[model samples]
Target: MFSSGHLSFKGRGEKWNSTDDGESIATEISSVTKLEVLELCGNSLGVDASLPIAEAMKKHPELKKALWSDLFTSRLNTEIPLILKTLCNSMIVSGTRLTVLDLSDNAIGPQAIGALEEFLSGPTCFALKELYLNNCGLGSAGINVAECLIKCHEAALRHNTIFDLQVFVAGRNRLENRGAKALAKAFKTLGTLVEVKMYQNGVKQEGISALAEAFEDCPNLKVLDLNDNTFGRRGAMQMARVVGKLTKLQVLNFGDCLCRRKGSESIVMNLAMNCSAIQELRLNGNEIDVETAQKIVQMCKSLPKITILDLQQNCYGRNWSILVSHFQKPFVDFGAESDDDGSRDGDTSEEESDKSDED
Candidate 1:
């Protein structure tokens, strides 16, 4: 029975069943009109309780964030689609300005995909910036999610605020290369996307290659997390090419992505040269040797600023001192020295141009 700007009953799991007490509480919650954020995650609020909450949320014209994750179990099969439809429709209504929505860990299968797709494709679109749909039982059928995002990108175009729609997180949905290709298309459409996280989605080289191409267009993209996926040597080469294109990129997480000798080399080669704005770079557990690690660290030393350069779990055992020296050396020292190196002039000028454009 809560109705403030933020409603949170996260861990009260299965305490209120389909009994009268649950109905009473739901009725009270429905009447609350000041709710802007609703968080019912980690609760076993069955269909009985969820319906009333959805109805209440519909009334909030200014609802911005809703987190109803982890509401699915083995027995609750039939109600999942209905719940998804109701919530999405609520956001679609006129005067509603929902932005951040998290429906992760809800076991949402193909049954509820249509409801979401319809809502995004509808005339009345929201200014949704962040969307999280991780571990939703999507399996290989996550292409629909990418389609919905495409529609959202189209909607944002109508408003001329495409860059406002930034973060799109769909991690652990079992989306393979097909899904990645679909999202790559969407990224091309929405060129202003900042952070895109598709970690642990079984995306391999082809999918990552598509994403790498997308990076060439999205110059404003800052953070990209593809951790725990399979981006082998070929994918790494593509990634290297794309990394050179993103000027504003700051954080890149490719940890445990199965990059071997050539792949690792390709990534290090471009990143050390082109990525001047990079702050954090993760390449742990990629089977890189000591020589490659030293090269990467040495190359990264050219950057004017850096916070973290993780190379743990690689083969950089005896030559770990190279990493220490990288941290010890002043980043400004190479910036001045690299100007004298005629070979690096083009890269330096391009980086400067990108930074000037951002200013």
Candidate 2:
């Protein structure tokens, strides 16, 4: 039942495949006098169902959040683009200024990027603050997202408004160097991003360097999680060079990034010198040596607001006591130490694992 301008069919496990199902949902949607939030996750929606729902969406210009993740479970890839196009176009026509648009876990491939281009580049998304596309399998087509965002920014400028996108999450998308660099360009243009999470995307040094440069433009950035990426020495150094600029950064997750001892030292030293608001820091499974890990803990002590320091699955040897002595207030997570060779079987964090299972 819809209540308080909010309607949710989340995790209903119903498959709305026919026009009759679409009309039934549309009738309920149109009946909401002031629909502001709609949650349609955990249910399968086909093109037939989407058309009527989109038409119903046009009646609600007050819509703010569209939580529509995991909506296509067994549908054909070809049908997804049309469904997205119809729904997003209706919102655009309704003159809704969406703040949060979560389409995560949908496996919307490169082909569907076109469907979202018009909606994102138009005035409808001028107020979009949070965009979630995790596990969408964007691949090389992520460039289209960047391009659409750039166009959105341009449209905002033309309309004398601001496209202040704050949070962007696109993990597990396999967006390699090409996709990352493209989004970096868009991020540089927006310059209002607060948090950027792109973990497990196979981004290497080249992509990371571009993103680091883009981060220089985002002075208000607070959280940056690039876990499970390949950020060897050069990438870490590049990121270190820009950490001084992001003085407002609070949560930094570089876990499983393979930022070796020297690279880790560089990043930690820079954070100590520049970022003072850092609260949570995760450097697990980075091949950090005992000496460098000690140095990291010693430096982190200077960060007044430091809370969570995760140094798990590294080569921390027998000096656990020395590291634990540094932080008595903040909880330090020092998972099982790695072998002398700094080898671990699985690098997925408990948090990431939980999220994966949930999605």
Candidate 3:
């Protein structure tokens, strides 16, 4: 079903569990002389099928992008690690320098970290620029990803190559404070990063502070999305300190981050003073009051390039209309008014509402 150097079975809903299925795909892979991109999403791949497909991967040294998300649906937890390891091994052996590797929506937990570690630190990732592992359920094991990336950076340096990773997305992984701190170390080291998105990771003030410090080193960062995380006053202030440094920032999403009144003020003030290239600014569900929202509106007026400003689900109450009128911008998304007393029940309900909105 594949032609030219590209093969894609995306959203096919095929359940490939047998070795025969693997061999068929392997045969097709071997037939492609200049294979560069392989997309295998929306299909369930078992260990049997993965083995042959992985073997075939080695034959195509030109392979650069492996869009392998949602490939292990209905698979045993034990089988996923083996399949992941097998595929990684083949890619490593192929002597190919990958540019984009996406393994999102797979639910590959901590057990799969070993395979990821080996693959990421190997020669295959020397030229990798974009890595996506969204909704992988990595939990605390997420730290391994950062550690392995550091190893990969070191390996690239030793080989006289630059590991200029540009984009990293790992949202909904529950990589709390410890995992965040570890990743901060890696991000600081890989200063070539352009975008970093780690939303819904349960990262608190400590983790946020660490990441803020790390972000100071990445001057090229354009997109920073830490949505649905908890960023209290301390965390928001820490982030505020670095917002002035990221002059190239374009999209910044901190929605549902629980940055209270003081924190919101600090961040808004910094964004107004700094970040002139900012295009989209999301501060929704941050418990911002009318007074702070006024400042945000004023900030938006100063940012000429800003296109989208999300101030939804905050403590705007009836004052939402006033704030909206002041904004004057058509791109502002001020979803629903909140309590007039500015009393936020808790972060749990707010985060749940945010998730439902996304769905």
Question: What lDDT, from 0 to 1, does candidate 1 have?
Answer: 0.70
Question: Predictions ranked by TM-score, top down?
Answer: 3, 2, 1
> Which lDDT tens digits does candidate 3 get at residues 297-351?
7777788799998888888766677777776568687775543334454454534
**Which candidate number has the best TM-score?**
3
lDDT against true structure, model 3: 0.86
Q: What TM-score do all the candidates reach, one by one?
A: 0.82, 0.92, 0.92
Evaluation by TM-score, superior candidate among 1 and 2:
2
Candidate 1 has a TM-score of 0.82
Q: Give lDDT tens digits, candidate 2, residues 1-359.
A: 68898999999999999999999999999999999899999999999999899999999999999999999999899999999999998998889999999999997879788888899898999999999999999998889999999999999999999999999999999999999999999999999999999999988878989999999999999999999988777788889889867899999999988777777888989998999999999998887766787778889888888898888888755665555565434556776434333532347553343344223
Cα misplacement distance, residue 92 of candidate 3 (Å) = 1.4
Clash counts for the predictions, in order? 0, 0, 0
Among all candidates shown, the one with the greatest lDDT: 2
Q: What lDDT score is found at residue 299 in candidate 3?
A: 71
Candidates 1 and 3 compared by lDDT, better number: 3
Per-model lDDT: 0.70, 0.87, 0.86
Q: Against the correct fold, how does model 3 do in TM-score?
A: 0.92
